[model samples]
Every structure is written in structure tokens, then in C-alpha cells.
Target: MQVTESGADLLALLRELDDPQWLEWPTSYDRSAVAARFGELVARLEGDFGVPCVAEQDTQDSSEYGRATVPAEATVCGTRIVVCVSKFGSLALVCAENPGAYLGTQDAQEEGELDDADLASVERALVELGFTVVPEELVESDYDGPSRAHLYGQRPTWWDRFFGTF
Candidate 1:
């Protein structure tokens, strides 16, 4: 039986898949599988989609076992995207226009012409790559006292936050 499926076929399979376990990491050994899948997609992103791709791995061990710090650069359908598997398992393929002023990745400054439709296309690509891509509510940082103050000029409070007050 052929297990590997084409992109459109896989996407159709994803649409029909209702099992939450579909996205779960099956075994610890699967990290390499995930990374290999990611690498294949990166090739497609660059070669088939005409997106410039750059991949940075923090370490080999990190890549093999840990969250797999594969921060990739791509331009899909005119949208310059930063495809990264965050330290957590959030596989985010965000447009590299402006991620966050202080907290976002530095590489997001490399802008492109990706619009809303392009973003949807990117999301489909992510889904095809076996990512859940759940929507998360933005949470306020708890480092309010000083780290927040230092980072965003929020005005220091009683404590210094990360380290002691200077």
C-alpha cells in the first residue's frame, strides 16, 4: 500500500481527519521524521513556489530530540514568510513584514507583498505539513515589573523582574 500522498491528496486527507492524535507527536523518535518533512517542504517552498528559503538549526541534538529549531525563510506567492517551529511546538509561518516590535523575531524585517489570500495559502501549506496551527489568544506578559519596563518602557514597579533592581 502506498503511504506517501501528494500535497492535494494529503490536504484532502487532513480535511477529513478528525482525530486529534493526528497532530500529536507519536514517538520521541518522530522528531527526525518531522524535521525531514519540514526539510522537504522547505525545498518545495523554494523550488516549486519560488520562495527563497533559509534554514537555521540551533544544534543537531536540538534538531533531533528537542523542539527542532528550524527557522526557515521563504517567500510563498509574494509573501516573504518566516517558517519556524518555535521552542514550543507552534509551527508558525508568519509573513516577515513585522512580527512583534520587541518580542518578535529579528528576521521579520525582510518584507514582501503577501496579502490575506496569500496568508490563507500559507496556512493550507502548513496544514499540509502536519501542523495543527491552532489560534492562540495573545496573553499579557507576566514580566511586568522591570523586564517589561526595560523591554517596552512600561515603567518599573516594586521589583526589578528578571534581575535585581539596578
Candidate 2:
């Protein structure tokens, strides 16, 4: 089946597979079923939009105090579109014009970071999402980090507004 390229269409496809009534077993115990459903969606997207879609299972093991990470599927059109599934199953799509470019590899053992193919895929996905792809130099801008002191030349109070104090 062909899927529409719009975000709304993608969201609708996700909802259909994620719906509780379509499954033969409980979702908690049916991991393969979930993967299959996602794969089907990806296939449809590829067929309809000529975009590549790939899913990676999230790692479960982590340090005791480590932050929880979402499971992600990387879709490539003109830029990289990362669709991450939160613990609660809600989805968020983040587009990076240069995927894995600035960031180093997660594995310390790995020799290098993301290569050109990775960046190309990211660029493709971003374009599929209707973003205009431009050279980094054209859009580059600098912003300083938040200031430590309050705007009135004093430290912020507990009730002080965040951005206002900065």
C-alpha cells in the first residue's frame, strides 16, 4: 500500500497500527507485532514517496541514573527525519539537516562519526518534510548560552520568570 508523504498522513498510519483493537495479543507481550506494523508503515512510505525508511530497536540497558532514551526510526527523503517513540508510545519527529554530522559516534570503539551517506539520508528526509535544504553557511547563526545573573543585575528569585531573568 502507498502512504502519503504528509506528516498528518504518517501520523494517521501510526495511529492505525498502534490502536489496541487491531492486535491479537497484548502489546506488552507482542514486540514482533509492533515491529512488523512499523515495518509495514515504512514499506508503504518507501513505495509511495520513494523515500528510504529504517527502524532501529532502542537499547534497554543503561546506568542506574542515566536518562531514558526514545526508540527511533530514521526516514530519509532530503534530510534525516528521526521519529522517536517515547516510553508512553507518543511519537516525536526531529529533523536534522546534517544528521550525525556534529555529533560523535556513540561507541567509543568506533573509529569515526557519521559518513556522507548518513548526512545525505538526513538531508533527503528533511526535504521530504518540506524543508528547504540549503548550504550550512547560508543559515548559520550564533547564539550565546543563558546568562547566570538576573536581568535587574541581581540573582533570580524562585518565582522569577526563566527567560526574563536570563
- lDDT per prediction? 0.37, 0.31
Residue 69 Cα positional deviation in candidate 1, in Å, after optimal superposition: 13
Give the least accurate 10-residue stretch of model 1, judged by summed lDDT: 157-166
The segments of candidate 2 whose C-alpha lies over 4 angstroms from its true place after superposition are 1-29, 62-77, 90-94, 97-166
TM-score, cand. 2: 0.29
Q: What's each prediction's TM-score?
A: 0.43, 0.29
Report the C-alpha lDDT of model 2 over 3-97, residue by residue, as the tens digit. Answer: 12453444343334332232222244345544544455455445544556555543242100011111123322233334322222222222242
Lowest summed lDDT over 10 consecutive residues: which window, candidate 2? 62-71
- Model 1's lDDT to the true fold? 0.37
What RMSD, rounded to one decimal, does every model reach? Answer: 12.4, 14.8
The number of clashing residue pairs in model 2 is 11
lDDT of 1 by residue, 1-166 (tens): 1113453453343234312232222123355665676676566556545545566543242211112111234333333455444222423324344233223222322333444444555456666776544221111123332124233335432112211122
